[model samples]
Target: MSTYTPGESFAHRLDPRSKLAVQAGFAVAALAHTTVPGLAVLTGVCAAILLAARTHPARALADLRLLLPFLVLLPVVEGATLGPPWFSVADARAPALASYRTLLVVLVSVAYVRTTPVRESRAAVQRLVPGKPGRVLGTGVALVFRNLAVFRGDLRRAREASAARLGDERPLVDRMRLVATAGLARALGRTETLSLAMRARCLSWNPTLPPLALARVDVPVLALACTLFTWGLL
Candidate 1:
């Protein structure tokens, strides 16, 4: 289990793997339908998932903030690849659809992670990968979740160390290069150690054993969610 205790609300009661299936359905539906209205509906569904999970509003907002950088970038690509006016019905549609798709996937993932144990999520994700991808991602989940605070502190210390060494005389570009190199080296070292430690601790992903079972009753609920998303996509 990760130090990050996922909220145990109504939504958390569902099987972790089931929620992931629903996310796959939503993602498929989002890709199938590209209109603004369709995307809005999908975004609303994502918001509803968040609400149902009963996650903290502040945390949800923070997650939204994570999407900000992408929000700024999505429009430029939409305009260049899709068309002219940034705000037009035709031009904005691609970006709007993209924004909503990104939001939907992110929110679903957040809700799932916030509900399931980090290890359980890792195990579920393993089902998707063929050979090495599963193990690699599972390793990330274990190390990243278990030592999240430490990793964050490492990043902060690295940045501060860079800042302290940076003088007014140094060019901004040079400072950035130095900071990037320092941060990358430190991050790589930490990850390598963590990976080795994880292996020593005997971590492996066997997806057959879920922390919670998908109850017989839960199947219809997932089926309903899938049906709704599928119908709307059409």
Candidate 2:
């Protein structure tokens, strides 16, 4: 499960709804400020949040690795589009800001995911969103968190099994295709099992989720969210 680490930090104690509000606030706030200094503030706040939650910095950077190549490519492509000397700060600024904004968003999201369990996340969505849309979205989020670890394990096993069979001699594209196919098949099988289990349990439209309630600790988090919105307005 995507779960909370054992901790007593303020962020760890804040209500999931409050954290969700702050996360949404951060995303909206990020859009308002694209300048380097503005982005620095946003990035700093995200980092601080992660730190407050006692998450390791290395883990935070590791979470960012998947997007690093794209982040690097975007600015280069934008700058190169300007011809000759092939480096226009003016042309590159937008792409750079966009990439950094994405990084900030991911960092904050990682902090949230690490500190909240899949169960709390599902409950947060259901309570905050309401009705059919809430149920659909909550289920989707829950499934993603629940299955991500399983998919990762499947991927690792596929790589090991491929290596055992001298699959390294195959072209990169072929190797990737094989692994992808294996992973998808496993995922489908897992899904079928889960569906059957749910059906056996009388799959209801309303699956019971644990209660998420606001507490005294949420006051500060809500305040921070309000501050973020105000800053975004400015």
RMSD of each: 4.5, 2.1
Residues 127-201, candidate 2: write the lDDT tens digits. Answer: 878999998998899888888878878988998899899998999999999999998898899989999998898
List, residue by residue over 154-232, the lDDT tens digit for candidate 1.
7667668766865435788876677677777877898799779868978655434455567875686599568757764
RMSD of 2: 2.1
CA error at residue 17 for candidate 2, angstroms: 0.4
Task: State the displacement of the C-alpha of residue 142, model 2, in Å, after optimal TM-score superposition.
Answer: 1.2
6, model 1: CA deviation in Å? 3.2
- Which stretch of 10 consecutive residues in model 1 shows the poorest summed lDDT? 80-89
Candidate 2: clashing pairs of residues: none
Q: Give the TM-score (vs. native) of candidate 1.
A: 0.73
Error of 1 at 232 (Å): 7.3
